[model samples]
Target: MMNEIDLTKVDLEKPFMAGLMDGMPGGFFVYRGDETKKIIYANQKLLDIFDCDTWDEFVELTGGTFIGMVYARDRMIVHDYVRRARESGRTSGVTNYRIHTKKGVFKYVQNYANFVNDYVEGGLVYVFIAAARSTHDRLTGLPSMLNFLD
Candidate 1:
């Protein structure tokens, strides 16, 4: 069996981890766990997803917060999902939501997030986002039921 790596010993800011995150296929970001959910890091894919050319531009558009990155209409839903998950003692969660890009376009995305309570910054959430294609299911190529729902 392969050796299991200890997550607590891994430092996300380290060059190796940073490089891995940057090379990932989807959008990735890290944010504070507080109410503001202040964004600490965002990979290039995330900048592209938001239609931003630079980190400064992304931060400006999102107000450096996860809540600010979400489309206003969907913020409450996303918040409730995370809140409920955390309340139920979940350290991670996945949810689909909409985000308004800098170009004034709204895109549906699936967010996968893991909460780390022992981080140097108290609590932190690492997230990965991908376009939520309503045309087909992720595992199978069958039609997606989400397309028929609101």
Candidate 2:
């Protein structure tokens, strides 16, 4: 599977679509460079969790213009983590994270992995974000704290 990921392509707009589709039940995601951190490819499950039907629409909504996703407070952490992962070829995962979707819904996204791109398909050492929105706050970006907040 690793052999199939191309890194040189760097087509942030739409990279690694085939691998992601082939690897089912897995969270295969890619974001464009220079921020807005536009989501490139997030498997079928990811789309269901976020309630989105298309990737192009997601890009149009989010735009490829920011450095990272997450609320302002958490952006730095994500940025630093992604940066380090790229430089060190590290792989890690975060549990119980609240991430926003293209439609403005927040879901529990558990991002993991840091496999460096092979420069054939243009993956910048992608990170796999496995997410589940079943019990997320959705509003405050918390985990089912809705009842308490309300």
Candidate 3:
């Protein structure tokens, strides 16, 4: 088996990290672990998923926490998961939740976040890969029976 990676020892540059993250199958973003958890980097796919044409727009729209986009009922789940992961020193975890899109609609989203620290000048950062694959009615945003099949 491969040895566990020491996250503190990884020294990846932003350019290299971006190149790797951009090719991921879904949206990708990095956010600092501060009071706001400010967005530090967002890949092109993430911008498209958020209906943002540019990074600046995404930053302005999210107001630092992507948690703002989550459905109110599901927001706590995200927070709890993050808290648990941080406590356990986990490198990654998957969270499923709903997000309110800019088009005034909601989409079920799955987020895979990897925790990293000191990757840059920031303290702690989370790199998230997210995908929207809700088995809901495209029009109503309500879960269909088919959602169970997924």
Q: TM-scores of the models, in the given order? A: 0.80, 0.54, 0.70
Model 3, position 118: C-alpha lDDT score:
73
lDDT of 1: 0.89
C-alpha positional error of residue 123 in candidate 3 after TM-score superposition, expressed in Å = 3.4
Going through the candidates in the order shown, the clash numbers are 0, 15, 0
What is candidate 1's lDDT per residue for 81-136, written digit by digit as tens? 99899899999989987788999987889999999985468899999999986545
Candidate 3 local lDDT, 47-94, one digit each (tens): 777787877776666665767656788889889988998899887888
True lDDT of residue 94, candidate 2: 49
In terms of TM-score, the best-performing candidate is: 1
Model 1, runs deviating above 4 Å: 1-15, 135-146
